[model samples]
Target: MLVAAKGERFCDQKRPGCSQCARKRALCPGYRDMSSQIFRDLTQVTVRKYHAKRSQSAIASSSQNKSPKLVKAKPSLSLENVALNFFIRVYAPSSPSAWLTYLESVLSCTDANSQLSLSAVLAPAIAIFSHEQKRPSLMYIARRYYLTAIADTGLRLTSIQHAVRDSTLMSINLLTLFEARAFQGRSPPTDWTTHIEGAVELIRLRGNDQFKSVLGQALFLDTVNNIRTSCAQRRIALPAPIQDLLQTLLQKDSPPLSYGILEIGVGNVVDNIIGLVAGMQTGAVYCNDYKAVILEGLRLDSQVSELSRQLWSIQSYRVLPTDASGAWRWSGLAHDYDNPQSARLWNLLRMLRLYLNKWICRAYKKAVFEQQQQQKEEKLLEMGQEFQHIPETAASNTVLMAEYILSSVPYFCSLILSLEASSSSALSSTVRWLIWPLSVVAVSPLSPVSMQIHARDCLRKLGEEMGSAQAVEIANMLDNSETLEDWYASHPRMIVDQKAWF
Candidate 1:
């Protein structure tokens, strides 16, 4: 009695036209030729398992849409419990009011399991736990929550309520921040542009009146800042919509500038300088265009320089009187010195100035080369004399920038330590905000090795305090980038992982 023949199996008995044997031109017995009792089972259990999981995945995906409620409650809240607790302790301390507002919103939400709530809870949790604790399971959980949140948002993306939309955006921002921290320096740099572009569209949909609130304005600034940072880092021209938005906001007749918006303006100028530098470097500007680019760069530099001076002037009025004398020294420590924001801002401006000056030197070098090539010795000599001071000035700025960063450490420490228990939120926020600028100075081509080490040390301390993995990642990244920069100096053809300029 022949039981049902087993399915196709490879055979050692070679047959000329055997399908499986044809490729290798090896021995094969026809499927029908093999006796069931003698043949070994050739079942692909592993492949079957793969198909089974895939089907299950598809089913789970469809189920999310069929009953979105299930997706919301799928992740056991217990998994996020520890993460949520950590967020309150570490992250929320920096932005008490904002956290309070967010807390109220979360508590008021009717559907605790909704995509909005899940994301709001899960992202910060994932971020905090991953940075503070190296739990392997947390990464997988984070990925699941992230995907579900993204999918849920996509399913009902259009015509979202304004309040819901705001919450969604906040979650998206958290997710973006999480990604920035999670990927470390190894991950392909997050193109924050995608989020900003979507945010811009959403802002337009939300209308002008929505920005009257403080939170609205803050969100707007964050979005613009992200876009601005991306453009400056990548040396790309600012997208027109964002450019026009900024221009309108920074118009001459607008209200007196806030420090935050002023920072944005400085970024704008930096972006312009970068764009000009990129053009000059790429030979996109010929001799005829060189003068205009040079003039523009110089003009922006002057504006930034003036802004730096003004920042000092304004900050001077806010300084407490010294015990020794009423007058405050411009370059010395002050009585009860705690604020480093001014110094930080000043150093950043100087860093930008140094970079701009370097580019100016390059422009002059190019011009000199062109004049020499054209046999204009008179112009070449004049250019040489004019540009000779530029490099020296740039070098001086580099030293000054490094000094400013190192000097700020005392003030920064004092500021953080002075915070009363009630003020921890502000303290943490202040420290977190400084990371970008610190990273900037850390990787500057001209930063002294000592300064770089100090910067990393400071970042590590801050990261430990804030449970921010990004700080550690950035420290490692800066070190690696510096090494790579040196290597590339000798080996220009080697590829480098160029990240966004802080």
Candidate 2:
């Protein structure tokens, strides 16, 4: 049926008039005309005593009961735009606690670029860098394993580069480097250099970058510096001098460096122990105790960073808002479960719970959903108490939330338009897929259409609530006289669908 639709935006919402209406403009219906029965629990509506004594110059007592007006919404990014990046970074996002932590975290990596889906997000470089230096010892654990795996035992190479690529040889070299006298203040023997080179090559070829942004050179340098500085400051004794070579490489222009480590979502003092699978035997240079050793350095960086990030996240989420439609809107909503701030908070808490505490990850999985829920509530309450009075920074948070959800409804309407375009059945064509959902939402709310019925209730109630001054204003607005259902059914759909369906 033909309809007098207004601006294209409202076409998904309402039309001014259906074909059946002859005087179209006045026939149009919309929520701007609807009666809302929200907040009806009040047992009495009190008139202001001041109004009884005031002259006609005083505003009417019934004005304040008007509905909360629906204001124009501001623009914001779509959820799909944000979700697109979510999948790519989940797995490697720069820490063992990132996508690598307990196998379950792998579910976050939906993007094509992330690698090492199941390894716990970890900081092995940090661990290695934190050690004390002492007597140097050399060990060759990889030779026997290599002898078992290599089929062509005599692959010859003059340079260290080719020698390490033969997977079997590469694995042996890493073991030798980690055990070498490097940490003991002795230059890493030739074998250690060979292993480091192999790791650099593997990282270049296989490591995913989108999410692996964490373990870059910055992290590596920080760990090495932290450990070396700590050791020097405290004069701690260690069996090897791991920091010496690391310090030398930090000075070099080029090294086989990953970000070396990142501290994005990891926790310190809270999440230290979980089950650790032995490091992957993949053809990477890092089989050099780097993975195992990086954890200690991470713990320190995490200790320093977590407190600040947590406090910031909490402060960001204190204020809640009611949307123009009178629905409560939450903020920083990534996927409805929680906002980025909340996720960061949870990540911090979960990580801290595991700090240096062994078997925590293996135990986290065993914890019930109810237990997790309890933890969330506990944390929420703790933060709520801390930042109870902060005002919301954004006035239009509610408008943004409603508009975001509303924008997508048009897309669904378009889909229904397409479906109706193909359906041949006349009866079926009018039954748009989008209508059922709208009908479900519109059927409730006791709305009054006449000014006599709706305005008195509207003004008296408005007068009873925000006071007589606000009440007179609200009642006048409600005097426009239309039910919310009129607005709902007035929305236009593509008529071409019926022709196609028939």
Candidate 3:
């Protein structure tokens, strides 16, 4: 009997090569040491097996003695389960089907088996869930992921291939949202503004073609609106490219689903007003163009008035009557049905009109100054004639609009609070989107004291429920008994300039 050599278990009686040797195309070094083959019997095999078992036992004992600490592996979290819960119970109510689809896509991308899921997308989602669940540990996880996303985005920014992808843009948007949700109003203002600014840069790099897609357009418009807020608050003009894109968007027949034509009209008028103010701040020589500036203001004001009239003419534009307590109520009855959306929209228009009137007053002040400087009595008289159309007391008009904006808060709050989850989600999103505007109204000095208190309490409640620090801060500011105008007067740097429409 031919015996196999040690470590040559594949050797058989084959003369040329063993199976392993043949597979490797190597010369067979077969079992040539056969001297002990005859002597090696069944007893030897049994002894060898016994020794092997004893060695295994000895090694196990030695290992156990050397290291008794055997930590069990921590199990991976079931992110999918949490995400599904978030989708069904929270997100679906607050957003549209499109957002739900986006969330699903992020989940699929982040599957354990796939490499496509990104930290930027994943981080904000985790953070949002963590905030909603009030999970501090999960918040830590979210922060880590958020940092990872930022680093990843930084790397991608250097790579055109990675940076221009839609996912990259979505990541930025999510991160901004994370800041908004996670920080609420506690973090520095730039925490969210930086993300917003980064998104604007990404949009610029992506260009007008990005707007061809529905999601791209939506994201673009959304980011631009945010940028508009940041710039307004900071008293800066939007980058020319962004300003141009906004103009182009406004020219379109339809805006985003959350925005309306009237809203855009209001935004346009506000932008014009803001632009004029910004120009005036820089000491631009507008004497040559004083008439043009006055005419532009008038034209924009007329545009707003016409838009307001259009809203009034809408079949569903009925105004809800005030209750006995003097609180505005949502009259959901037939022919007097309360469309929260229409009410909100109308309130927004009213606010814009008030804002436009204020701008007209400023324009008059500026034009009057310019005329006085030019020593043109005839021009001054002409300007005085044009100014006659404006409210006699612009400050009173300001208060009226601010009061109206606040008066509707009760109805809005009740509508949002009382509606079914799905309906509330829709209205809540609209209300949330209008936070800056609402804040504007809340802080307006002209808002009545009682209405201001109502606005403050309602805003704080909404902020707490929605996890918006901006709302909470606005409420706090109102609670301090300072109107926004007064607050801005004291802290000129914190002026609320409405350059973008809701």
Candidate 4:
């Protein structure tokens, strides 16, 4: 039989393999036997394997159910914790004020009142954070904290020992800041003034002992600095107690010399000028004393000039080169310093000069007006020869001081612009420091129109980006009036009254 006919092709039944082989001239392979062709089914084996795997899984799952598993719970953070961390990590570091830097140490104190004072910090911290985060509901919580702090501070004030503690003084300062932040431009003057006065009285009570510790000294300096600024803004003299306390602080050997201390010295001279101007305005000093006032102003002016020279010598700043395009709103060359703090010191010195020279110019103008009136009445040129050029000189100096102030703007703006998105907290302090000087420049009669416009824009930037209400208010004041006198006429509740000065 042929091999190709096996299994697939069948041979004829008669002689099957023999006939096919004989016809094809080849042998055909025979079919296999029945016993060699047997087979077994795999369905039963597959079903058994599937059942075994399912049983194994069920057994593993039952064992797993009998065992216990552990899960870690997330730690919960309270709002107080969140606020404090924000203040310490964000708000405190960016602050230029040394007093706020001491707050971290105060927060770590174990005293009962110190803990209460920590609550005081929450108010301002929450107020600022909520404002930044745009969470209006958090403001209610901030206000509650403010009231709690006030009550806690009130209770502490009842005790003589507690009242003089660093915690108590710090609480008062924090409350003052809260008022400034929470109420902002709309806050009543007395709201913060009362706290400042309270802190001053507490410093008086603490006496020389307050200077022994670093915290005490920082608080004292901070309080004095604040009151000095307030008095200048209100056009009043420093309180008698504060004057005595300042003298005591100066006399101390423990506290190191610092820019703040130097600024205080300048501030004292400023307070004197304010008092002199008030006297002249109220007729407490007669026209005959106008020359005396001018003489006094000149002496004070020299003293401040000397202080400025000393300040620069000790902690010098730089005048960086600028492009000729004058694109940054700077008047001339840009002013820079070793750091933001140094720049602030220089700006403050300039501010003091501006104030002093402004008063001096006012005095000169009054003297000249009186002289003209006298000439009109007596028909004589009896005006002193020495006074002829003084008015013009004073006016020029005032304009120059205003220019210097405007020049410092580039330094601050550079710092602010260079800051990273993560460092926005520092913007507040930097903007706050810039606002007062810029406002002064904007409202000055001697400032050029371009300088005034640039100042108003900078203030507007501060208000929009840094959320400073005072800056916004000042910018609006500038927008509504062509002159400072017009602004005062339109807004009677402004810090400096037009009637008092004009």
Candidate 5:
């Protein structure tokens, strides 16, 4: 053993002991041999230590048993599960077509192709979630998934069996929605229209077979609705194939008196109006024909109005009593419905009516201008007297339709904000549908200043709260464009030419 003085560094263990002491010329103690002392007897001390340890272990075991057993930790949910759940809970319910509900079964399937369906649904879910949460990084992830879905969809389209599959069409439709919401103001306007065109072509390929299943029928109706909106926005006539497909669907299905049925009727009138607008823009329909066009619009308007009346008569709504505190007031009154679906149908009807009256007003102006150029002063005066009430009535009706749309806003907003989770799906559908009506009313020249302001505010709120990028874009458009003409001028894609009517 080597011993050192206090404050000296300890000796490093070595083969020989007392090296430092020997180096210092001091006495060195001999090292002990561990082998010689290997078998020391201490049975009494060992027994005491073992007994003490056993007693401590017994105490701990008894205390643990007296207390509650530990709970098993639950596994955390995966990102895919979270995103999928969000889609089903938030997005699917709000969708008017309910075609998305089919995704549950598609995704539940255990097959290689089901991965594509999962990606397709998740892409939009993540995109919407990113927008709602203001998470830009998540948007890149969303786009990656979107690209994957597009690739998968393209592959599926190569085969007729896969292309017409409900899962495949659902993916395409979901991709279209992603375009509308995720890419709206960012992507070229034609992106959404082109996406919809592709879907329509697929539907044409499927033909009557598309309506065989309930899911397929819902998807077809949804695609038709998208086609009408796209054509209207593009200032083009609805494709003849789409018209033929719709007629075929009606003849074969003969859908019951419902919101979808009423929408088909309104869609026919809308298609005619869209064609009239396109013709007028391309000089196919001359200004001299404005009178006949106005008459046609009125007739279509009457037809749609009758459809609206019949639909509402079957599924009526109530005007919710105005809040005394004015907290729930939107343009002074809020209309409540038996359900959000009915509310959505009603607003769409108002929108079609608004468009009809708007074009009718344009036709009236054009007809009056043509008469002024050709007719003599006396004859022109007489013509003016005869047509005096037409424009005024159209304008007045346009304003009223715009107001009615505004009035419905409060009810939708209330439902979206206060409804329970179970009812959120229907509420969401209503809110999503409300965005278009709100945008239409917000930009209408005939809308009163107060109504326009209210509509714009409602749109802003929806964009902020509901994550509707379209609503935000429309609000921003309203903000930047001081007048309706300015809006049209800035968004040239929405109109065919300067002379075209909105």
Candidate 6:
């Protein structure tokens, strides 16, 4: 028999290395007998999911039985911990007291450094309020954390005070900034009143140059832009002074930001821009005034380059070097999406630009002829990779789309984990986890309704990923397809095989 030529079989107990498997998985059954099929099973993570956590629990237990870390099982989670986790995810309580009680519960524990305390409540508290979608009190939870930080860490330095306020500011800034970035290319918080308020607060707080300037500087441009923005919104003057300051800043020959002052300034700017664009108000006034300022800023902005340089230096999420043409394609590494604007936007912009470039190159061939030509480049980092040969069928198209969703699943999972304490994000987390298997049903030989049920299940889990239009585009590419045939007819091969067929 030509079994050897057929490649490794999972049915065979001896499996080849992944490199070998990669060369051979297509022709052969995986090496674990039918066990290789485990990877494809979209069933709930189920029993096997707890392998490490269980080990931790056992260690926790063994520590109780034998070790010092658990003299009285100090690491043991308390009822408060449970309640904190519960409140963080479900919001079962109608009042802020419920949330505070949970935080207090964690605080009641012996040492403040308990992993359960931070992991279960505070960290997630940050994530939850960040995406709560309830804006009545944007920094409502931040006030809680501001107090908690003081309680937990004991404020000593002026920077500690600065940190407390800045952390809260960062939370507000990050949420709005990302909202602006993802909703469209609009950047920064542009609301004049808010920017002025924030700047005034910093000034009043006796902030240092490093500490205070971010607030003041962020306001300087944003307030002007916002005032101009409002005028533009109401069809008012372009506000030339604002234009001049923006130009002066853009033109000023400055070195890149040093970590201390630079990050604060740039971060504040980013925060403001983030808040600004989240409003998504489009107009000729913004185009002529604020838009020009931002473009000029970008052209002259060293902060972005600094950020880009810092992002490039991270070893864990390393993507390809900037292409020969200096193109920074998105590498699709939202694995650690702590910096979603940088990670998600980087890939999205790369893809968007690539798509636009393809269209331009085709429609205006002479333009490309006149311009300097650069070779097509790969995405900066892998920008995520494609799955292997999904079964070929009309369903393959659906499977293809689903696999991309599955790939993005980890990113959403990271978000969920960050918000694990927040019932909302937990629900989001659960939804993202639940999405994969349900998606798998459609691609499998299961009945059509099974796929539909799976589709419904997936949409339910999609939470944040499903709510936005762009996410909807990604989702439609995932769950929203009408017929498997339509995807087959219209979907490009790359689109179909992004994950499996890569």
lDDT of 3 by residue, 1-502 (tens): 3434334456667765566667656666675544223333333332233324333333234434543453211112344235334533456444422333444443344322221224554465566555454566777666766765665455556656666666677667667666755663232456677776787788778877776767667667667666766665555666788878777766667675566666676666666665655554545644336565656656766776688777777634434555545433212211132665566566657666666666666666666677778788573636555465554656666776665565566656566666435433344354553454566665554445655555566667677775555567667766676455433332211222122235
Clashing pairs in 3: 184-469, 185-469, 443-484
Q: How many pairs collide in each candidate, listed in order?
A: 4, 61, 3, 4, 2, 37
* Residue range 1-502, candidate 2, lDDT tens digits: 2233453223223344343333344444433321112212211111112213223321111111221232111111121111112212221142222212222222232331221111011111111121211111101212222222121112212223433232223233223223331223222234333433433333333223211333333333332222222222222321133323333443445343332122222311222211121121243222333324234424433453455365455443332233334211222222221332233333333222222222222222223243465565453223334222211211122223222322223233333345443312221222232222222222212111221242244234434432333234334434453343223112211111111111
Local error of candidate 6 at residue 298 (angstroms) = 16
lDDT of 5 by residue, 112-148 (tens): 4333344577677766666544566776667766766
The list of candidate 1 runs beyond 4 A from truth reads: 1-63, 66-82, 85-90, 93-103, 106-117, 133-136, 159-164, 190-193, 204-209, 249-261, 277-290, 316-337, 378-388, 413-502
Each candidate structure's TM-score, on Cα atoms with residue i matched to residue i, is 0.63, 0.19, 0.65, 0.73, 0.70, 0.27
Stretches of candidate 4 off by over 4 Å are 1-77, 111-116, 185-187, 257-264, 277-289, 376-384, 457-472, 482-502
Give the Å shift of residue 230 in candidate 5: 1.7
Cα lDDT tens digits, model 4, 1-502, are 2334544444554434546655666666654433212212332232233324333233234333433241111112244545555666667666534567766555555443334354477788777667555666787778876776776677678778778888888888788777655653332466767787787788888887887777777777667766765665555677888788777777665433353556656656766766765566554663456667777777777877887788788788777676557545564567667887666666666766676667666767776688787666542234457666775777677677776777777777777767635444455456666877888888766667777787888899878876776578778867877444333222212322111111
Candidate RMSDs in Å, in order, are 17.7, 32.3, 20.0, 24.1, 20.2, 22.1
Model 6: ten consecutive residues of lowest lDDT: 493-502
Better of 3 and 6 by lDDT: 3
Deviation (Å) of 310 in candidate 2: 7.7
The all-Cα superposition gives candidate 6 an RMSD in Å to the true structure of 22.1
**Candidate lDDT (C-alpha), each:** 0.52, 0.27, 0.55, 0.63, 0.64, 0.33
Tens digits of per-residue lDDT for model 6 on 26-112?
Answer: 544333333223223211121123212233433234334443331221222232233234343344232211113233333333431
| Candidate scoring better on TM-score of 5 and 6 | 5
- Candidate 2 wrong stretches, greater than 4 Å: 1-161, 164-349, 357-502
